[model samples]
Target: MARSTILIADNSCMIRKGLRSILQNLENSEVIQLIDNKEDVCGIVHKRKPDILIINPDMLPGDCLDVKRELFNENKLSLILLSNRKNLKNDLKADGYINYMDGQNTILDMMQEILNKNNKSSFPNKNSETISSREKNILKHIALGLTNKEIADQLFISIHTVVTHRKNITQKLGIKSVSGLTVYAILHNLISMDEVK
Candidate 1:
């Protein structure tokens, strides 16, 4: 099996240290670099050509979508944008997003899901289907063990709509049980594992 190269770009030393500590546990993971600038991201990515690139959304130049497109046009490199704000979730342009607050195990699972894949093309792309913000909100509630009626009330939607959204989320992500969806939510940064019940 080939070893994985991961590049982490964050302005905070603490954040970089935390992620490196978690990611280093993966067997055969190698050549990890913690960078502190947005301008250097493209240069490093071009030079190192890491298998996976983890970066803070705030550290990216201009709109993240544009930066993702320009810097990650190669399908072999998977990009993950990390953020703590719920509202920062954008359309599924990058491979995915990770909440910086996730537990160590959840972070490991998310990265392994990308790295252990047989082919890089299996990673999420611009054309891949994504869960809507409303669906993501409902998913968070469901993961917290809320009833469909309770979720509907909380989101100001009908119970039937809540069911429909759940079904859509299931179909898009191919995850059925509440636990599976909870893991999915954590992996996608729709909700942190700490927020799950």
Candidate 2:
């Protein structure tokens, strides 16, 4: 079985080394590298393409936000932010974030969580955002396995309108895949499985 790789990025080599040691000890995880140069992050990621990158948000060089985008957008790397502060009351949209604490935030827990996530993808939807009437209609139509064109015709709209509605629905619901949307639609009684099939 292939082991999962974690790439660590921080300004301090000491911090990186410590994290590297902990992560390498975690079951089913291998440390790809523990490096400090922020400039190296994007290049290394493009080359090695580790499954996840553990990066210190404060120690970033240049535009870390852009780096996050480039890594995720261009290189397709998942990011896990390492923060030293507690009580992150505000919403920050990273794949995950960890404060450098001792207790059950152990390397073992991190590894298990990541691997579990790999096998069974989970989306944390705490908000349960209310869908607009139009998005809900689009989802219902999709659940019925109607083509966008069919939905447009049924709803007396253009195919582009149906497509636009779908985009809005997924965004509002934070659902990225068809199966996720379908399951949600069924759970909400928007449509039946038989209808989709």
Candidate 3:
């Protein structure tokens, strides 16, 4: 598995240090770049090509929207905007947002969430095959100890439909047993450990 590289582009010393501290603790994390220069972030991202780029929209040089558009156009690196405000504007249109008002835990959680979604090896299929919403709900239902009949009833589908979905889920996930599926659901945050009982 290739190590994941993360770049932090915030001019603020405090925010940079905080992000670095939080990111270094993640597994498979390789390089965490803390940008001291407040230049064109998109150019830096194009040059470095880090797995993820966390930047403050307010700190971007020139038009923030233009930079965001340029970064979006590049499409190689994932963009995560960091904001000190509680309510973020809809204009920046970043892939992810971390609000400073939500505190340190929120930053860490958001970063981890983005990394999880973007990390290829995080899933059974190397994150190649996207799990449909219906499949995810079915997986959750199976993990919660619901039988095919019960699931069908809850989902308003036929028992045969539930069985077919179960077969497809097993084939896609490579998890045959209900226990294995339960563990997968828990690890992927589809269901919580507390909800297992």
Shift in Å, residue 182, candidate 3: 32
- Tens digits of per-residue lDDT, candidate 3, 1-197, equal 45778888887889888778877777777555788676766577777788888888776766556466665465556778887766665667677888776666766677777777776445445433656789999999999999999999999999999998887788778789999999999999999999996
Residue 148 lDDT in model 1? 95
Lowest summed-lDDT stretch of 10 residues in model 1?
A: 118-127
Backbone clash count for every predicted candidate, in the order shown: 0, 0, 0
lDDT of 2 by residue, 1-197 (tens): 25677888888777788777666556766887876776787677778888788888765555444556755576545677777767531434566677777544565676577766764443354235789877888898787778888899899999988888887788778887777888999999888767777
The CA lDDT of each predicted structure is 0.78, 0.73, 0.78
Cα-based TM-score, every candidate = 0.56, 0.52, 0.55
Query: lDDT: which candidate is best?
Result: 1
How well does model 2 score by local distance difference test? Answer: 0.73
| Model 2, residue 106: C-alpha shift (Å) | 4.1
RMSD of each: 17.7, 10.9, 12.1
Q: How many clashing residue pairs, candidate 1?
A: 0
